[model samples]
Target: MKINPAHLGFDIDGVVADTGGAFIRIACEEYGISSLTLEDITSFDVVDCLDMDQGIIEAIFGRLLDDPLDAGLQPMQDAVSVLHSLAAKAPLTFVTARPHEEPIARWLEHFLQPDTFKSIRLIAMGVHDRKTSYIKNLGLKYFVDDRLQTCRKLAEAGITPLVYNQPWNKNGHDLPTVNNWQDIQALCAE
Candidate 1:
């Protein structure tokens, strides 16, 4: 089914940004933990899935949360181009669980064209749960997120949630999904 651009919203971390990949990279490069891979991130909470030190996990995530730009957090494949296309149709909306908006905002600004960045309505709500109200407030009928729990919550709240395909959320969901930005683009009606 095709959705209007104006009624669609996105999540940042796993959906738009390659947060898991960055975490793996940082673990391999700086922390000298070379055994990690994206597939091994079977859980959204990295500490739960990987047999790594909790302190190290916290430090890596802290770095990403504090300065995603500096953490070398890259956009998911084809996300930038698709976002630009959608932005031309309507102002882009991103609702993230990150606590502070400035860091991820800066990261987005770095990747998106200045005009696209200006057209974005980003909300860093700081909590993973209870995003239904914020999304409803934005008049979004559909939201794409990688966290199954959040998607489930949205679904229960009477919103259509597109589960952004990720290893961490690959199971325990029966919702419609978008595998990549190309799939996301197809979901948009021309």
Candidate 2:
């Protein structure tokens, strides 16, 4: 089966890049505290648990002013191959909550070739819950994201949400989940 979507939406953090570790590390550094493991930061809120100021949070993680790609960020296993396969079939759009676009473009450039990601479009900034609106506006046939809330919102808005399975989202067994990009490729192919 060959399923070609008009547009596909993607989440940036756990979906593409291994940012959880970096976020926690930066948070610890900003607060002048001991290095935090991923487990320590997983259940804790970025603002409260890390004791980080808004400005520092924005500068390090929220805002992508700096070239995060150059910061040695790595793609999730087989992410590049899956994306390349998907792009070969249909348009791929990165729908992230990251406030800055340039850094994302740079980060994507690190993993994907210039031509493969040239058509990739960035959605509105600071629009986390409004992902359904973006999908509706863009006429995306399907969206792949790591957030269960976002996936629910997308489903409520009449879009097929492909939930990217992550350890953080494992508590509930209700949501539809896919293990990795390979599963997404298979889903898209169906």
Candidate 3:
């Protein structure tokens, strides 16, 4: 089924940004903690899946959330180009679970062209479970997220949630899913 750009919204972390890749990269580079792969992140809560210390897990995530630019967080492959294409049809909207908005906003600004970034509607709600209400408030009929639990909640709330494929969310749910930005672009027909 095709979805209009105006009716679609996205999650920032695993969906748009390669948060897991950055986490693994940081674990390998900064902390000298090699051996972690994207596939090793079997759970959304990294602490639950990896054998790493809780403190180190929290520290890595803290740096990512607090300063993604400094952490060198990169966008998912083709996300920028696909989003630019979608934005040309309608304003792009994003709702994230990050607490502070400024850091991510800066990150978006850094990647997106000024006019494209200016036209975006980004909401950093800081909580995972509450996106349904905010997404509804934004008049979004569909949202793409990588959290199975969040996608389930969105489904329960009557909004279609396209589960963004990820190692953490793999095989976790039966909802509709998009594996990459190209798949997402296909959903936005005309």
Off by over 4 Å in 3: none
Tens digit per residue, CA lDDT, model 2, 118-177 = 877766365687778877888886787777778888888887777777655556647667
- State the TM-score for model 2: 0.78
Candidate 1 has an lDDT of: 0.94
Instruction: Give me candidate 1's TM-score against the actual structure.
Output: 0.98
Best-first order by lDDT: 3, 1, 2
Candidate 2 shows a clash count of 0
Where is the poorest 10-residue window by lDDT in model 3?
165-174
Model 1 weakest lDDT span, ten residues long = 124-133
Error of model 3, residue 84, in angstroms: 0.4
lDDT of predicted model 2: 0.70
lDDT of each structure? Answer: 0.94, 0.70, 0.94
